[model samples]
Target: MTLEAIFGMASLLAIFSWIALFIFYPSKWIYQTLFSGVLIVLGIMYLFYLFTGIGSLADFNFDSLEQVRTVFSSDEALLAGWIHYLAFDLFVGMWISKDSWEKNISRWVLLPCLLFTFMMGPIGLMLYFIVRAIKTKKLNQSPFH
Candidate 1:
């Protein structure tokens, strides 16, 4: 498949996973499907691209922004990087959803956090932290706590 098609598929999969979380909150099947079905698939793709496209890590070091940019100069490397972001962000979103459910945080309040997490990973997580702190009335060491 073309890289563009792969990107589109991954994006849609993540979106459907998020929607499933809303529809099936706290379901083991949903978590399993996301982790095994979505994340693992994405991980395999990431490895394939990283090994086949990026190749020899000795040639690249992420010690600086320029180095990072150099590594992502290849389209394959860029796609791998983008997939990395998509997978991790979706994982983080899943964590947030599960955690919020455990904490009894309303889904209405979580919508924005999830949306922000989808568009901008850290920003959505930060928003979740704020929401969590406000909802729980205490800032804990771990997000899960």
Candidate 2:
């Protein structure tokens, strides 16, 4: 498949997953399906493209911005990079949903966080943290733990 086609499919799937979360908040099946299904599929695509593209990259390295730019210059590598963002951002969004549910945070409040996350990953996460701190009153709680 062409990179463009793959990109479109991935984007659509991500959007569908996000919508599912919004509609089916706190549903176990939704979480399982997204985590075990969509995430795994994206992970496989990420690995396939990363491996396939890295071998052909003459200057593949993460030592500097220029090296990273060179690595992503190719279509395959660029697609893989984009997929990486999609997968991780989706994962973060899912985490936000789950955590909000646990903290009794309202879905109405989560909408912006999820939307920002889908559009720009970290900003949404930061927004979530702020909301979480206010709602749960646990400012020091680490998201990782």
lDDT of each: 0.86, 0.91
Candidate 2 Cα misplacement greater than 4 A, ranges:
56-59
Candidate 2 backbone collisions, by pair: none
lDDT of 2 by residue, 1-145 (tens): 7889999998899999999998887889999999899999999999888878777645679999988987887788898999999999999999999999988899999999999999999999999999999987878868663
Model 2 poorest 10 in a row by lDDT: 51-60
- Residue pair clashes in candidate 1: none
Backbone clash count for every predicted candidate, in the order shown: 0, 0
> How do the residues 1-145 of candidate 1 rate in per-residue lDDT, one tens digit apiece?
9989988887787788888877786788999999989999899888887766667888568999998888888888888898899899999999998999998999899889998998899999999999998888887737545
Candidate 2 yields a Cα-based lDDT of 0.91
Error of 2 at 117 (Å): 0.8
